[model samples]
Each structure stands twice: as structure tokens, then as C-alpha cells.
Target: MAPNNQTLGNNELGAWRIFSLFMLLIQKGPLPSAEIYAAIYSDLSTDSALRTFSRDRTVLKQLGFAITEVKTGKEKSFYLSDSNFFNSSYDLSPEDANQLLVICSAILTDATFVYQEELRNALSKIVGNFYSLESGKSDSQKLSASSQNKVFPVLYESLSSKQLVNITYTNSQDLVKQKHLGVLDFFVSQRLLYFVAQDFSSGTESASIKTFRVDRVLDAAILKNESFSIPEEFDSKDYKLLDFQLGLQADTLTAFVPKNILAAFEHFSQGQGDVELLSNGALWTVTYAHEDTALSWILAHGLIPRSPESLLAKWKGSLSEVANGC
Candidate 1:
């Protein structure tokens, strides 16, 4: 229904359309077809847009991306109920068996199950944090050791009380050492447990924030009566610090993708950025966390950089290096 010519390839335009549909649902949450039609199919007449929407929806359903339509008083609205992104299968480790033992010890130590309320309230928080919900065939997270298990409860306590702690941590090289830290928070990413803390072992004046995987901690002792303050400007958001999002400089990049190869770019964009579908190609605008990140995407997708001379130079240099290698 929408215009598709050799000027811009079908894949690019098609992918953008699909990605836009998904993002439309994400940004606005529940959206009725009328709103979607206006946003995506405004160029088409009502009849044409309806036909196009039906075809796209059918294809998406076939792909197993469940976009559910709920009946809302004579009108239907779409909603994305869930995603399997974090519902991953993890195999239980020996450390998990170790945790099972610790759990049993805890429950047995508690004499009065009375209402089971107090026991439930206490163990729930610690167990839920690192529980292997279901053991599966995949070996995603193997255990380093359960020694960190001893330290975690102390870390959790300090985090709640704003108390400082002294800990001995073992690195990948097996080098073990002790340091004082102020635990800020704990988070799970990709099924592993990690805590963010400020290292103040040297002194409160030279404290530095860092993320430590829970399993690496060898020992912990809560420093009672000792506490620390987080820096006022410390924003939790700026610290997701996932590898791709971390870089030396942040730049909003402009990329021109050929008509045919647009799908790849669209897929990468996930409709989180701006896109201008032109007769010849698609102009995509997004911010890259670093020059290397920009170069990686552009080189992989064969995109032409239209702005940011620095990125263009880096692209050229990469191409030159590749040519020399060949």
C-alpha cells in the first residue's frame, strides 16, 4: 500500500514500517488501530491503510511476536503483554545445591514457624535474589564458588543500613585482597547477580563506584557504625554502562541506508530513533555512545554517514585498513 520503488529498497522501507508498528505499541502502550493507522498509514486512504495493517499484523502473528488485541467497548486495542527476553533457561550449579543446604539450615535454625510470616519475610528477599528458579540444559552461568554466598548476606545488610563493609574479593586471576566498600545497590542482568558499590578502602576521600559480581566476593564483614554518602550527582541511569552504550564520547549519528538494505538498519534501530523514508533510501538518526560503536554499525550495514566528520573519517580509516589487509 505504501510506495516502494528501487530508489529505496523494499527491505529498508518494509522493516521500518514493521519496527515503527512495534515502537508505536511500546511508546504509547495500548493503541487502537485508528491511532496506529493515523501514525503509520496516514499517507494511505482509510481502506488501503486497513488492508495494509491487516496484512502486516497477520505476518507478525505468524512470527510468534504476540501482539494481542483487547476488546475495549466496541473497539479493539493492541498490547504487548510480555517478552521472553529475561525468561531464560538456566542450569543449576553446585553453588545452587550449596544454597539449598544453606536454605535448609536457615529454616531449621528458626524454632517457631508459628505463622511462618517472619521466616517467610526474611528468607524471601535473599533467596529470591539469586534463586535458580528452574534448572535447564543450557550452561549459561557456571559457578565460580559459593564463598561469595557468605559475603552476600552481609553486603545486603550493609546496603539496607547504609553501613560500610570490609571485604576480601577474588579476581579472575585468583588474586585475592581486602578492601572497604559502601554498598549502594544490587541488580541482575543476563541472569547474573551484581552489586554496585563505592570502594572507600583507601579512604572516603578517594572512593570510586564499581560493579562487582556477587560470586567473586571471598568474605565480608559489616563495619558497624561506619557509613558513607553517595555523591550528589551520581545518577543510577548513567550507570547501566552496558558495553555498547559506554564510550569516550557520545554523538548523535546520521546514516543513509540504501533502499534494499534498510531492513537490517531498521532491525538494529528497533524504532527507537528517527527515520526519514526517502525515494532513494532511508535517513536514520540515532545517537551512538562512541566513535567505535558508530563505525561498527555503519561498516556492518554498509550505511553512508552524512554528518559528523569525525565518524566519516573513522569509517574511511577503517575501510583503508581493511583494504590494506586484503
Candidate 2:
């Protein structure tokens, strides 16, 4: 049993050696089986070496190496098909490259972000690969400065440390109010950053979740003495901003969307619709809470509502009003 175990270990070591040798040889150029066997295992007999090489070739293919066999006259040689396999390079389109540069420039120019230095260093490495140092620096300097959100850093810190925060916020109606909140998460929407928090002003046990626009916050201070735990069942996705209207009841609405504006409709709906393809267009069924948003989307995209007679009539009436105005 000891001798058998030693033999198995030796076999495994030999298998790894063959695999490495095969990879090295194929990367340099195609080599015939005889040449590969001779180069890898000089001590073994040609027949034995050839058998091992053949087995290892199968293993290499299974491991996702793009090794292809080519027949030059009578001899077969194996070579890697993908030339850039060992040193892969990203091939971004011109537009995508420009966009990436723009975003990196924005991040580098913005001094308010907490991770500014780290982010700049990382982005410099990536952008440096494509653009010259002088060009990258020039672009960064030319980029527009970010709109300052004074409370953003404070909210970020509170969210990270699981601490309570007291904020003085101005509502849309220009009324100022102060509240204590338990931070849950943060997200960006429509170029504005918002925080999802639990309202502690209503008391702890019956606290309700709410979203606060960071830009509207007049002042924010972290409460170091108090900390809060996030609910085990809470998911950030469930608290994302939906549309302009809040707390409105959602109704299932169906529309026949023309092919030309289908993409626009999908973008407005945020991919929340069931779609069926037609020869000329697509039929979409969506659940929307905001009537004004839905109405504007329908008018803009020339969408035809298919169900809920009341909605269809409303759309027609709106179109009629527009027609009269024209």
C-alpha cells in the first residue's frame, strides 16, 4: 500500500509537469507531438512520453485553453488560437473610452468625496494605460467641479458607523425641520444623492423608513452616543425611489408600444414591464403608481394604451386637448 501511494503521487507530479510544458511550448509556437514529448521528458521512452502528452492535451482543452491542432504536410502541431491569451488587453470602443475618461476626470476633480485620493490613484493607473500623463492631468483640471453637498460626508460616516444622525432639512415647500434618523443606506438618483433612513422622531419601536435628499439637508451632525441596527430582512432595492409620486396606489396598465419608441418606453419604465413582440411593435403590461409620469411617457412616446378603459379615455382626452391647442 505504501509503494502504491508513492506511485500515485509521482504520477500526479508528472501530470502537472506535462501540463506546464505543453502550455509553454504552445505559447512560443506550434510543435509536433514528437518534438513536445522529446522537449518535456528526455528520460522517458518516446511512446510513453507521447501517451502522457496526448492525455495532458485533453486536460488543457477542458481547462479552457484554446489549443488548436494544425497539420503541416504530414505532421500535426498544437498551438494556442488566442494570441493575447497570456496578456489580455481591454478593447473599449472610442465612445466608451471617452465616457470612462470623463467619469475619471469628474472623480479626480471633485475634492469633497472621502475616497478622493484613493479613487484618483486607481483611476490614474487605468486611464494612464490609454492617455498620456499630461493629457489626463489636463482633462482632470478642465472637468467641472461637483455641486457641493455639505451633509453628504456626514451622512456617509453615519451610515458606515451605524450611528444616529440629527439633520436640519428644508422640504420642497421651503419649510425647515429637524429630525433624528437611523441611517440604513445611501443611493444616487437623478443626479442627486439620497439617504434611506428610519425616522427615530416617531420613537424607536414604531419607526418608519423614509428617504432624505442629501442636497436639501441644511445641516447634519452624527450622534456618536447612539447606534442603530439595520433590520435583518431589509433590502436596499426595496427602498429605491420609484417615480415623482410617493404613496400613490399602483394599477396594472397595458400599452401597445411602437418599435421606434420601444427603447424610450423601457427606459422610462425602468424595465418593469412584461413585453410581447409584434410584427410592427411590442405589447407591454406595466404597474405604474404615478399617473402624471405615465401620462407624460405615453404622450411623449406615442404609446397606445390597450387596457383599463379609464386610462385609455384619459389618454384620448389629453391627446384631444393637445389636438385642439394645435
| Cα lDDT computed for each candidate against the true fold | 0.62, 0.61
Candidate 1 Cα RMSD (Å) = 17.0
Which segments of candidate 2 are over 4 A away from where they belong? Answer: 1-148, 247-268, 271-290, 301-303, 306-311, 321-325
Query: Model 2, 137-229: lDDT tens per residue?
Result: 345332122322235456655665678899887665769899898877754443334568888876657678887765566677899888888
Estimate the overall C-alpha local distance difference test score of candidate 1: 0.62
The ten-residue window of minimal lDDT in model 2 covers 141-150
TM-score of each: 0.39, 0.46
Best by TM-score: 2
The Cα error of candidate 1 at residue 171, in Å, is: 2.8
The C-alpha stretches of model 1 lying farther than 4 A from their native spots are: 1-146, 204-206, 243-326
